[model samples]
Target: MAEYIMAEKNNRMIPEEDKIFALNARAKKMSEEVGRDKVINATIGSLLDDDGKLVMLLSVVKALKGLEPLDFAEYAPIGGTTDFKKAVKKAAFGKHRSSSFVEVVATPGGTGALRNIVANYSKIGDRVLTSDWFWGPYKTITGELYRELCLYPMFDENNRFNKKGFSEELNKLAADQESVLILLNTPSHNPTGYSLDGDDWNGISEAVKEASKKARITLFVDAAYIDFAGDEEEYRTFLPKLEDMPSNVLPVIGYSFSKTFTLYGMRCGAMIAMAPSEEIAAEFKLVNEFSARGTWSNSTRSGQVLVSKVYEDEDLLESVNKERAGYREMLIKRGKAFSNSVIEAGLPLVPFDSGFFSCIPLKDPAAVSKRLEEKGIFVVPLAKGIRVSVASISEEICRKLPGMIAEVIE
Candidate 1:
């Protein structure tokens, strides 16, 4: 018998352990970064009130109040409310599909839909493709499941979509894996507030088709901000992927009422999967239903009921839509102001056209964020650039962005 001796080598993590720790640490750091407070957040995604409070979409809340009658005491079905699912489909993919062909499931939020979409399409170690410009949560949600978040370049130096870079990335992923996933966020992007142009959508579609020819790839579109993008018809008409509803190339959309109707804390959203055939759609429905059961056990039943009720009421929806359009245009004003100041200051501009987020390329993202915070401004720092949440920022706050960056530079 030999006595065991304590050794430092035993404490060292194996390769798998090291990789897990890296992921854990990255997620932890991100959670902390997004939780910071702000006197004037030039880099926020949520809308703010005139008093600098987070704007609660009162219309949605009022709509939700009617659902109190539904009772939380009752356990909702795994598939969620039928009315809610129908509403989601009407709002998301429209009536393009054969009525029986369309299917949807309630999810905790758009993010829940995202997880469900990914789970239905992929397995561990599968390559998930998204634009280099993307929501931070993609890494947390996809990576934790052991999938790789592959990034294709989104915009060029002028902040326009880079088709070649996108094509290359898709081709590479298709060649390397049996299946690949591509996530497209529009009519606007988070943290950048940009949407794809007409030409860009065409390029992306061809790229998706090209990649699909090589390997089985799913296109997941996050149309979370479709309500704020000014023109729904333009988006609906152009994103041929949504209208055509391809079969070999599956397209799943994550629709969130959280932003459009301003129901943030309520957490209401749905996932709609468009498969080539009803059989495949049914298969996805089963996975999504199971995901709903296992994940959150159905989204807020009351919230779903409330939104459905609102959708059915044309008079109510029209008023809400008009008011929402007003709020959305203000965001455009605020963002343009920020862009103008950045231009005047001779700072680099990150093209933002669609959603609430935009970024400026900086030498050090963390340093720039700190300096902005010191000036009573707060923002998000990303690998490629500094993300600005234009919807939450006021014209006054937006005007100060360039000066804040100048101070950081000095």
Candidate 2:
């Protein structure tokens, strides 16, 4: 007889260890053995100060500490507290709020929002589309939902957003499926740090608008790193473009407080829908709320209260933004340092604007990452490249890494 199995058959093959977490664990163990100064662990995607301490916004911390027991201990409504929904919309849209009917549902994080989208928008065995360089969890989310993840090349020969490839894939998928869910992570895309400009957004809008003629289109914008991308208001200009699309083309924005509010462990975010009509927006809220109840019963109340408290008070909001802007400047400085070093070393890097991460495309990324590990340096190895977390490292490390990676490649 075969050995008894515990998990459902479909779940049995899931990898026990997450690649990033496993690498991070190894890096930490090494740090314990030697010292932190000797190690360069860029495996995690969290903001860290120069001394390698996790950076938390003082304003956010104060607000959290001030919350009364009832505010945090009591259960929030299934969808989210009313104030949270309002605050999340404000946080996500800023001054570029959409003109369409809108709805919001609280999710554990951007991960949960993506999961809900895949669960509701696409049928099992259907394909979900995104750029070639995307957050790895996208594949995980789609796979767990029994859906396929497809990709279009992110850049063309000119080293720009590949609008043609995106259109081709969108048209192809729309033709085959009843509905297509396209995930676009912009204003600081992971691993590559590429943000879509107005023109790129226009191209996407046109492509989806055209593709919607063939099938229903759900345009999911994952703005997980938006706050850290650049000037907050400037990075949000593309948001208005997400509005006024054909009724068949639905725009969904995944907003995460993890990065925006430095509440990573709080597991809080929201899925926002911009529908052409009130009926569609209501339908979105109902369906996503049902999904939320079935999966994670409710998001953390404390996190919701933190957002509400901050947003409701203008003085506190300004303080939080000011603190966050300072960190954003630090990230920009680090990104510039790395980009300059890469150019000086003649290292081939994927096009990066402003974001927490950047990628160096190459063959055998895993092997190269392993070699770097031996040198007390750790970075994530993707299918096509090695990802370096600029947010987690010091400027000195940022400046030195390109040369070290170049030497390793040679």
Candidate 3:
């Protein structure tokens, strides 16, 4: 054994491993023991074909392959190239672009953007607000920065966005903290696949604006799954609402190419900040770049260049969106099939609307998940339920999965 030297922050750290990967590894081994078709592996959120292979977009791959060697060998600027930054902002805003001053900074992935936001936006020990059913990594990110995560019940009894609950929590958090950062991952939320519609966004905006009067507010929108959620333009309809926000309220978007461009390994994404005034936007850019320099130094150059090239070409952009539409439709179909099957099987689930994963509520999620695993079905067990990855399996499997889970739970 070697002596361990650590900072005060590092001293309290215990080994924290993601259970999803462990479950996936076990699923992979079982798949080998019994043929691949015999096992239901719904452990990961990544898009996978019926044959359990990774799905990549042809247009995205072509753009990457066509890149010059220099692109791969060089380092991107801390804030990314101008063209790439503009492309990301355009993608985030759609045609209804925000009139506020906006600044974009390249990060390794959406994860990096989340990390920066948690580290910089809130003071140490402040609670970052989100829904109860959220991506597990949000807690990990906040905890690492010495910030606590506070969650409101995600839905009401009627299975709609719990605007009332959210408002209550927002006010409570505002009372406790001088600065509040609200992170909403929507249009296909992780673990539950729950999405907020236009009305939901309006309520959220109103709540944030109201809270800003009592406490400085920073709203972070994590749109990593936006492309796969539904019609691109329709999902972005609420983005323009951020324009002309109160000076104390800052709206920042964390955009990722991992799912949109099928470039997960390339690790390219952007953090976009919108402010009522140009001075605030400039300050946002400067601090973001400074953070980038201190952390990863720069994002991948070729990844940034490829995204810029694809969006810049009208034909290529059209082709990419068309191809994505096919997959998005498939995901929607799979989601519907699973939800229908769950309803028919008399199994209860959290509300779902266009997303990669769904949650089936259970009293003992881990016990239920293990029982399902014994029958060759693997899923992630969350605090409130078992998370099924509709994005990873076939529609047929999705239809069959709920029945399998119901048998074990019931």
Candidate 4:
């Protein structure tokens, strides 16, 4: 008599598109009707040029095009090639010694890395901790793994990192959970554009070290937008802070070439485990490889080869960095222009420092987003705010956005 049969876990599944993609569709339709230049489409996270074209790095395109058919056809190692493992660690830690005991596993992208972490790190029915305002996928990933994502306040009254709230949450999780997985997305955080300062990192590490007395603490740093945030080495200075955490606390980093190399569709990334002991590091490698085998089996060999070649070849590396720098500047300019315009318009935003998007707290995000769409401006509506993708819109559009949002919000 049943209309359909499914597992209890699959009962909550709904066929639905993400809010950003839905708004992106509406933006495209509006653009077709009113002309692209007249419509500000800041619905997606990808970088776009002043001319409103999707920005693809010539370096990445050349690398992919240069690959042989065999390279594309072959299967990569389940955990990725040796060269890719080295390259990812180099990219993430730079000259930092925090990666001394780090082991790398190739993933489809940062999303895959996060999936492995949520699957292997947190116990079933346990809760993972992150900021209240976070990337929605974190919740979805945890839910699918039969775990939950808990939130701690992200900012204080002064709009600084809420160290006190974070410490409280860590203590609470340690008291109840056998293992706690903490996700910190920074150096250009999603939707909010908030990056943690060195002091903030120190406080977080200290808190985690203290919490490790009772529970296994795994700090998962999702640095998906690091390249666009600031000077690469400067942003990585916080890695050493994590290095000083107690042996019971493991620090894993998620690195993606999606934003960095403009290899979004290529889906190349790595999960790095910083284990205090050699035995632990080796075990991490084995288990993560097993996870990869059970999941995608292997990632794209061409993508892995591309990453290795770019890192190993000085000339190609220079070209890649140059292209990235150009886009990074464009993003910075757009962000600054938008921030200035917001201040000028007296529009309150979540203290944005650097990133592709900025969020404005709204009483009714869905309704406000609808109103903006009616005005030919499309943005993604979040639980508590409207996210404007400055990376996808031009500086000119960025300059005009705040006033429009202010008009709608006020």
Candidate 5:
């Protein structure tokens, strides 16, 4: 009798738990043991009010409640409703009209969109490229799909985007692989909260255009936190640059409503492609839809309906934006408070612009995180740093955390 009775491929897959959620559970247990007010739970990625309650947009909630039973109960189309697709395009592109052919495919969330991209775009055992400082799930997704995740140093000595390093790695990858999938998470990136500016985007575009001469390049933009980044129109200025890429280079946007609409559990999002040709656009839709059918067949109808309704009605859209803006401001305040405190405490943090989470880069992240946990401060320790969720903590906690972390580090 063998100690293990699983397939060869499944043999290496060990039962592992998500570090963030595991820490969150421990935080909740501590909250119950010692009063909730005494513990600072910065492990969760979701936005929480100053009162430590999860924040949900009332307008979005009302819109969902107003939906007819059939609207939610009925199964959505394999791809998505036509109206929903249109709404997603409008939401993603904003005022930037592209000359290239575009297509959209509904996904469970941004994660599903990423999965489809990895499944359809890259071959097995191929390398998927991204920044070294990335969302941990990127590795998990690629590993599960029988692909490898590769990295480029995210920043330079000046703490700016490392365009040179990116181009170097991209060229290196293109030399070996015929097709390359590059995942760029920006406009409020996870953990680090770093957003690439226009200069950064320009550098990226130039690099991609140059690399496309040799290999087929799929530029995947994970824009999950775009809505919370900053000025709505200003943050989206980089989108138009993706329009004029070479025929071999495809720009795909992964849009998620989980953060924007606060519908995390609903798992609603879309994978949008800006193709240089009609044939490419058609193939993008067909391949992703086929992958969706094989995986999670249909998305949440209610969530799609909610987004469609919000975009379809001008007033509803305005209301939803207004409500969401308030929460965005709250998040900004919390982030600012934490940043300011870190500065005052002489604590070094990763380049943080605007987002739910920021990271403090230090050696022995796990050990430091354990020390923080002993003090009833729960945070997710990453490979290079500990992630502090400013969105989940109050402004007061945000102000206090830096000093506490600094003390622990010292």
Candidate 6:
């Protein structure tokens, strides 16, 4: 009698749930359902506007302006270039420093910095808080690190910040008095497209201060779309105030060059940690350096150098503004078209001001998404809603959304 059993190898014998596989499977199902043509592809995070591209145009062609290209072929320091850091600090914080310490570490992009920051700072059981309508990756990244996410509802029907719910949640975290982590992606909320305005922004920031008084909560501001938010002058008014951030509360910013510069493939980002104590800032730098070294070693030197030039050249901002303005116009146009069509088609939608995406309500989002695809349209089906990216969708294709949606509803 021979006994046959499959032997398990260490680390090799893990369960293969493979959520990525499930995600792809769902995508395949979507493509099959939607059919070939009439596909109003409202999916992805890349540029839809062709005008703003000229902002980084000079840097691209002027690669031969001064230093050799190979000069950028080497590895940058783990902490990034002094010039780049200075420029980014200026871009993000403007001018004001009550920080005990302040410094920047170049990351692969927001994801890289977020990875390093979480690895360096958040412990296994740390309770991380963020808006319910947040970037999906935050959950995956933090969850992979075995951290718990506490979500506060983001908006109401008026499409305003849910300050009451936000305060209640923060107070709950404070009552526990544990190391609470708060992630804020304001200026323009994604998926919802709602940015804080008027007294609301002040109120929310004040509430954050209140939460800080109660417990050691790290306020991580995920400002990936800072460059894209409407009215740069209006939005930037609060950044300079970060210089006044407290020591008990470390206000770390996750910055990105992905959207602003349209260098999605460049994979460039930075983490600017502003601690009240310079001594604390120094420690963060050292730890951050260690974390960077352990992970990516260093960022691409060419990108670091190129971004530096754009920063130093004040003339570059004029081009950026021109480009940004054009992109803003396109976004507004596309968003209006979709909203109007959605209204005509009688589909309820998530409220938005400006940013990447918009959404509509649907039960069993995946199933509904499949039905819409049969009509030649694709969308991202979230748990509570479906996401649409206006940029990737064409005007002709955009016009057809209402009809297709009507078909699905019928």
lDDT of each: 0.73, 0.92, 0.88, 0.88, 0.91, 0.70
lDDT string for model 3 (230-256, tens) is 888888877877774778999998999
Screening candidate 3 with a backbone cut-off below 3 angstroms (N, C-alpha, C), the clashing residue pairs are none
Q: Which segments of model 6 are wrong by more than 4 Å?
A: 1-37, 49-67, 94-101, 240-246, 399-403
Q: For candidate 2, lDDT tens digit of each residue in 225-259?
A: 99998888999888788885998888999999999
Q: Is candidate 1 or candidate 5 better by lDDT?
A: 5
Report the alpha-carbon TM-score of model 2 versus the true structure.
0.98
Model 3 — which ten-residue stretch has the worst lDDT? 7-16
Q: What global local distance difference test value does model 1 have? A: 0.73
lDDT of 4 by residue, 36-149 (tens): 877988878889888877899998799889988988998888999999888998888877876448899999999999999998999889999999999988988898888888
Off by over 4 Å in 5: 1-15
Q: Could you give candidate 1's per-residue lDDT for residues 222-332 as a string of tens digits?
A: 889887777666666554555453456777778998887888777889877766778978888898898777778767777777778878998777777777878878776
The TM-score values for the models, in the order shown, are 0.86, 0.98, 0.96, 0.97, 0.97, 0.84
- Tell how far residue 61 is off in model 2, in angstroms: 0.5
Please provide, for model 5 over 170-271, each residue's C-alpha lDDT reduced to its tens digit, 9 standing for 90 to 100. 999998999899999988899799999999998999999888888999999999999999888899998888886887999999999999999999999999
User: In model 1, which regions exceed 4 Å deviation?
Assistant: 1-38, 93-100, 243-246
Candidate 1 matches the true fold with a TM-score of: 0.86
